[model samples]
Target: MRRTSSISLTCLVLASATLGPALTAQSAAVTPDMVQTGSDIPAKWEEPHPGYDYEKREVMIPMRDGVKLHTVVIVPKGAKGLPILLERTPYNASGFSTDRPHMRDAVWSAQRDWADDGYIIVTQDIRGKYGSEGDYVMTRPPIGPLNPTKTDDTTDAWDTIDWLVKNIPESNGRVGMIGSSYDGWTVTMALLGPHPALKVAAPESPMIDGWMGDDWFHYGAFRQVNLDYFTEQSSQRAAGSQVPRPGSDDYQDFLDAVSAGHWAEANGFKQLPWWNRLSAHPAYDAFWQLQALDKLVVQKPASIPTVWLQGLWDQEDMYGAVHTWEALKAAGHASNNHLVMGPWYHSQVNRSAETLGPLKWKGDTAADFRRTILIPFFNTYLKDRKAAESLPAALIYNATENHWDKFADWPGVDEKHLTPMYLQSEFGLALNKPQAGEDSYLSDPAKPVPYLAPPVEADGGKRWQTWLVQDQRPVATRTDVLSYQTPVLDRAVSLEGAPFADLFVKTTGTDADFVVKIIDVYPPNDAEQPEMGGYQLPISLDIFRGRYRKSFPNPEAIPAGAVEEYRFRLPTVNYVFKPGHRIMVQIQSSLFPLYDRNPQTYVDNIFFAKPEDFRSATMTVEHNPQAASSVLLPIVSGK
Candidate 1:
């Protein structure tokens, strides 16, 4: 228990609340008429939940194309046949409102503490987004046998769980699916086809793999700040396209004037056409795997009971939770699965409990992940109960000794493949050790690095995991950024699993863009702790897009410096490098606008580039050991 004291012991249960004795018997007196409810109310109504007794309604289910979606259940007051926690979303699932009281301090909501802890929550709105209907197919729509107007997303979540287990009343037929990030891709697209009252799922940080290359696109590039600010703060009225809401202080000062790029009189594309149809798809073809969504985690749909939440400093859907946990462990379903990964980010359980970024954990890692790993993982498999069956199918948290360990698997058989730490002094990085003479850089797809992350002003803050560690500390203080260091740790260095980067290079130009960064410096502490000024200390980072390395399905054109060998996997970390921390690696090309401008001229389609193929490309970094450029940590040891 020492990842810096597991963020001060999960910040004292991050605002402890099982709904605190039902919000200490109500009345903290908030009234917009206590959130309005009449239409002759009754459908087993009761509402007024600050503490408990909630039971609200609004059902209308259908959808197999017969369309009728709109759901919002709730339930708490003496609920008996429980077990139905679900949460499908295109966002507004009517704020999961039961007269809005149970926010006993939320950072990730789905009715805090599952309606006074008895379950039966429900909250839907999938088909065509708001109010639900028909046309809103973004993520996984094309089912098996490869495309033929397939109709999927698990057949609209198996006709909305067959009309909520035949009209919901105290439904204990059992069902469980949690949310976070497109409600974690609608519980990984409603745990695929298997709906016999589902069983359990916990998708957190998912967009499963839709906006391509993992959330709004990255490796195939074009995630220009979360698909241009989530295509202008979503609400295309599910694509029929409607507008008039824009004023969040005039869209935060037009994203502070396009986060300073001056994108032609910024209206960020007059309310984002899903970021202009994702710059009309760039590479990893089949139109981003027909809008990915990890093809619904390799269709394991059913034997449920899973729990996956990732955030190694998340920075938005960390490769859709590491490629949907490696396609649900290659479809064998890893004995009912459970994975966690911490160092939080991307709404790290509602940021700001003093600090998460400049590393200050000692408490509330999102209320101890909703009471020690989501209420004992829904009281051990949707209330059949055993309360975490001897726990630890996996429970990581480990950021720089931020604690929470236990692991039976999920990258923990005590990995230790460690070796490549090359990049000798142009400034940093050493392992096979040598201080040579080689450091070239001139990337420029028309002057990049404006993907934006300087103290976050917004316009989807150019997504290199939202300027992670301020985009590798300005590409390690650029000279065309090439710092790589590793000579500061004598004893402690625990980096529990998954991170690869191998490159042997040469590129003067025919096509070039190699960016790799993995840092976590922190040793020079204090500058201000007024509640930790400028949160970002244990320093975690991630970025990779070297022309999708070798085949994310064909892309080549690097003839200039000519001498290539690229491989990148980086992004999946559990970090722990104490004893005065320092483990950096930064190599650059450009993370600009969170990746888009390649144009080194392989152009079959880089979204029709022609700003004179955005010139500038001299980039190399081979610091020879027989050209073995490095970074491949897994590292864990002994029992």
Candidate 2:
């Protein structure tokens, strides 16, 4: 049969090469319409080469609700008694293609260190997106009062794990779940009443609360930084189609839109249900509170050993891992729950993390994490249950010192350890509170302070990941931005946890937004690194919407020209303010284009506020003894 087929194939090739009468005659008559005429596909097709090392099988795994989700399972050749590692994603699961596929070449994160120490890898497209079946909902809330549906991420994940353990016949029934961002969120879902086979999980950079400090909004302010993502994620079932950019500069483009709601409507964003929901609930109502993972995980606690991987500079979903870790501990899931905070951006742990912006660590930080932290955790729980656990309660990287440290407890110290770094007169910052002083700036919505310097990229084109660490010198002199600095530190001042921004602020307008940035200013004469010399690297920063001063669920107008105390938690920081380096604070009303401009005039919703509502406002930061505006630092003891 082989010889007969070869002869026939050779004859066809010869005839085509010779331009025979049949071919020549038909070629002239053949039209574009007749290019592919017959249903001549093989009844069963096989891959020409299924790679040398691994075996891959694509399957539609059945969910409890009868929706078959597209899943790809890759098992290493000559494998037996190996546990399965699952990663559920809305992105296509075909990323694990076995034909000539490298196991380490994971989507989003190349050089997956965990892949080296093998497990049968499984990647699945969650229902309603990519190759999966069913309707898609944006960050679909878990099945509850909020998501009164038969199917949710929890059920889907549970079903997938159940199917994987039963069918994958690798012998060991234990399974480990791990992923980043949205994939990370799914990992957490699987933990809620997890399958008996599920042993361990690593949710890297998970999204906890959209309204609190996650992907959607921080505090009461919408992250205009994620404006592009907001539309791109939900407008389609697949991963294409983005909100068309009106101009090259998003800074100007966003400002020109007057309000994000009007701009969203202009770009046909009204078609997206989330957009409407966002418009409906601008406050932290039941809609947002119910889906918050920190709150949810606490209510639905589990005992599965889990690791929460957080990036100190994670550009997206920075709030999740830490918050969930804390919530779990408070709920008495402390023994199994672990936290790892590194000095990388987003999911940098999966890739090469030799350097972060200007600061290069001693070695490949990401590689070190996978080797020391991830693999061992997986081994201890999934592979060898009797193995001696070397993992710490909290493994954190000190970016300022370029070293990793393990703590018995995160923040290892209480809030009483907090030392107030007061904002003083003459644009100063000191441990001593000033007797009396008030510094003011006139902030205009039309000329809102730029988040980054001029020639800024649109939608974080290039600077998204390390924008937090960018030099703050460009806008230091801006009249609208109030810069206050502490003298060069005589000794190292190490911070262990979340820094609180306590401001005694008064605004000429009824409503305002305050952006507080805690920066590390380098000395002018750094001999080792000139580029980093005089660099103003921001360590912690966050914005607070003034209307949410008294209450988050309910917002009221801030009495114009009246003093108000607005205290908010900045992003957690584990760093050292080295000697000769100055600690500075920059206060501004708008971190424009990154966040929507507060109209300064209280409105029902800032998203729908009219152009006329955006007026110039004078913001005052008082450091008086009576109302001391200060930054509370969480000093790590015996550092």
Candidate 3:
């Protein structure tokens, strides 16, 4: 089942979702209703008005190194001195047109507010993507003082901004940038000593670093399927290449590829330059050090005002937004830095829906966010409008209460808010450390735990987007997973910050992986939501490759039968465990497909390991008074 060319890999990867009948049925049930054709705009948002007379034009903007980027500009006709709103994306900017009705798509419909505000909106294809002419560098590093001539995203952005302010008509010379995911990364790049014209930015769900917590890896563990899919989709030689579909049983194809020991060969890695580069660097070395956003904040703090938007349940880049915000604040930019998190997925900030997965909000969450929060933040810095009095340093939405809350700063700017919930024997969670005892489980790489059930197809589909909030009942009873839960609470326990797992464990093998999940267990007889009864909703979760426990750059084998501590942070979440709901902590070794399986045998690079290297291992979690395993929940005081 070796996929040869990059084009063939793209086809097979695109078709990866065509699993058997079981997956088809499961996907039908989980697919979001927001996938409907026609307008994504709500009926209330569609009010007739004297539409803005806008002119659209496409042009090639040259970078400092002579690379030309394809850009699209839409300006209101006869309007003068309008500020510029820019978005750079690898997803292609050709789709950005002012001719469409307000109800067209979420991206287009989202601009209605900006359109009504009479601002010039611009979208550009990043270098080496779409109509842009240049070589593509995945997660291009920011420029530094020593390498002033280096052609990176920062130089490209600076050149683009300089050209736009000078060449575009009716421009106020004030520029603001916004984007999500890869586009978000571009916005972050613009923060590297931004051009004088760039005033504001909002980077949503940006991939801060591949070595840390982002799309490529999570704490040293490779994100196998995600990396494969994204590389196949974005690293094409030509823009707008239609992704080809694989034959039926796409899930089987992925499984067969994994069993064969080389995902690179299985996905046609040899044909793509990015894949080749990715394969060459399996460890956190100089290759990934250059892409670290935290380092960039410390070295070059952007004095320009910026706002970060994050989805509490974002499957990818959740840590990037929260950590980047923290880094900026630590760099003494707290006054101008702001963060807003809501109950949404990766790019759902642009959506207009009120419900995500089985959970429903009180009102249209996305619409309200865009109308009240997003638009105003940009207006203040870009258009020189009065700042909204309602905006705060941190604005977070509570999932259980279905209302927004404000804070002076994220995590309350105090360390006392962090509370530890200790793990106890017999599947219990308590505030106090229990008697000396331990629990053990056999982890077989051959039968790695599935991250989500009803089984995910190869193509990922909607499941990939919504799986973060999927019900965890499928793996709750699995023997390989250890579950520790607290009794139903008498009062609501609201968690407002990042949660971290402190586990003291022993393993029979040299190396392993640790996966921790914080879940909310619904009551059984909640008649209003029978389908959600006893549902174990994961609030925040992450995997830590045990080899990186001491250092991310160095790999060391764990001594057999030796107790070691593995502490890692899960993505932050703001949620209330209402009365009668239980808080659960599930620990496991592997999250298949979502993360690559750890062979349990110490190897320099697991990516290139032989199939025979994978072995079963006996792992134990100690819960003694001294070696107490617990989860620290950042409980907001007086919540």
Candidate 4:
């Protein structure tokens, strides 16, 4: 959210967390006597405000190495023995609750529940950026071979907590952490070697592995559509640092530029250190592997309670929370690990989660989560001093059923539930693999398929953010995209767990990128919501860059006109195909601006490929006994 914080600097009190001297008021107005004879400047200038619901202190807490981190501490008036709520964000510390006229107009809506209950709320700028002093490194790797300094996010968090417990007298020495996205990443770092006072953590939509399925890339195709994010984030310390917005559509901008490398350079993205390093390390090498939180956490896991929050349609950082939850369980640290997935796009739980694109939920899911799930979680660990046995291992939102489900353990794939849905001749989808059939489509790089409909807005806009839930009907009619679907079902088909795309294909070009989507086709005559009738809702989708099919680190060219298997897993879902609805599978070579257009022709790097490399390639999908192509679904119980 490009926040609309209206906190006036003049009204806020400035002091250290150790109760430094506070600024009293606005500078004494220039009197007539001072105007006539320039008076000597006062030895001390002060800015202070009194009688607020909470005492605001802006302190610079020192790290072990003597570098100070800027922190904002809010102690409610008369609060005693209250647990501390800490959120450390690269997005400015003070901006969290800036412009509040009263205590009720607190931080973001997500934290309102906690704010209402008494607690000493604390926010801090990580290490660099804003009031904190130090040079900034984007997602700095933990201290080891990657980071040699005595500080990383882990050390900073540990130092910050140690200081707060000792300095803040109102607190009961118990601390809990909460944040989303990169801020959520900091919470992950804190868990690596948690401080004694850090009792609980809730990381929402966290960035686990950038190279796998986070904001940066999906399997190896860089998410060039959000290139502006690199410019804004790495260019400056202040959050929401904006650049010029193009009045034209994002599709046209990317189309003209041809490649992400060119687009970034044209838009002045070269100056940032992170962009340069990211461009250089296009593969999952040491740089990215070093930063993958999932791998790192397994080696040194945390035992304290941590609730992994995920959005069902999170446009950004979707892989993190779910993947972490699974990883923790596999590593045998499952007891303290909990998972909760909501019907939301990136960070939607922080706001109203009533609807996403064409789909509307029965209730306000966000408020419900904050109240029922999040509040109870923090309360149990921070205050109750008891085991969180009441909470289930997983609390997931059934998007199809439109309700929540709590299980003692996460859902698993069973052979009985696994069904192979095949793509056969005549654009048909069936349960059994077909014999000797093939479908061909011409995928032209010049006229790549758009992720969303025409007049697509900038990536910064709402349309781009919520495009995950947009109807898929717009592109189903295109010649480049191949559609295969089962006939309208007379019975409901519920799905759970990850759907695997096993495609056997031969491309005229040596290299290609395949985009697969699993959709739910709405019936024509819907009485409840006529507007949603005939809508094609995408339940699961993802892209796989062909060159990296065999090896993520090493890229190889595909042999022309030879059948090769492209196997990859799509995002898992807990959805149901209603009795009247149809299940569809669409396959195409490109997903346009969302993912960088792959030069069907093989080259050293698609980013630096010449214009001649962008040629039209015909892709033939094979479905026969020898080369079967199908989507493997994990069927949950249904009629």
Question: What ranking of all candidate models by TM-score puts the best one first?
Answer: 2, 4, 3, 1
lDDT of 2 by residue, 1-639 (tens): 579999999999997888778777887896787787667797767675456466768899998878999998877777899888888887777854434466555423532555577778888998888889999887889888878889999899889989888998874998989889998989988887798889899999988788988887888888876767766677677775567875678888888899888878898878888788877899999999888888888888888889999899887877899989988887778899999999999988887899888888989999877876688888887878444557888999988778998888886324677899998889889999887899999989999888777556877778877887788999888999888998888889899988899999888899999999999999997899989889989988888999999999999999998899999888888889999999999999888788888999999999999989999999988999989999999976677
lDDT of 1 at 402: 61
CA lDDT scores, all candidates in order: 0.62, 0.85, 0.81, 0.85
After superposition, which runs of candidate 2 have C-alpha atoms over 4 Å from their true positions?
1-38, 96-98, 101-111, 385-389
lDDT of 4 by residue, 171-190 (tens): 88999998899989999999
The alpha-carbon lDDT assigned to residue 162 of candidate 4 equals: 100
TM-score of 3: 0.88
Tens-place lDDT per residue, model 3, 347-372, is 88877658888889988898888877
Assess every candidate by TM-score. 0.35, 0.92, 0.88, 0.91
Q: How does residue 245 of candidate 1 score in lDDT? A: 30
Worst 10 residues of 2 by lDDT: 105-114
Please give the lDDT score for candidate 4.
Answer: 0.85
- The runs of at least 3 residues in candidate 3 whose Cα sits more than 4 Å from the true structure, single-residue gaps closed, are 1-52, 98-107, 144-149, 230-234, 239-251, 259-261, 412-417
Pairwise lDDT winner, candidates 3 and 4: 4
Error of 2 at 455 (Å): 2.9
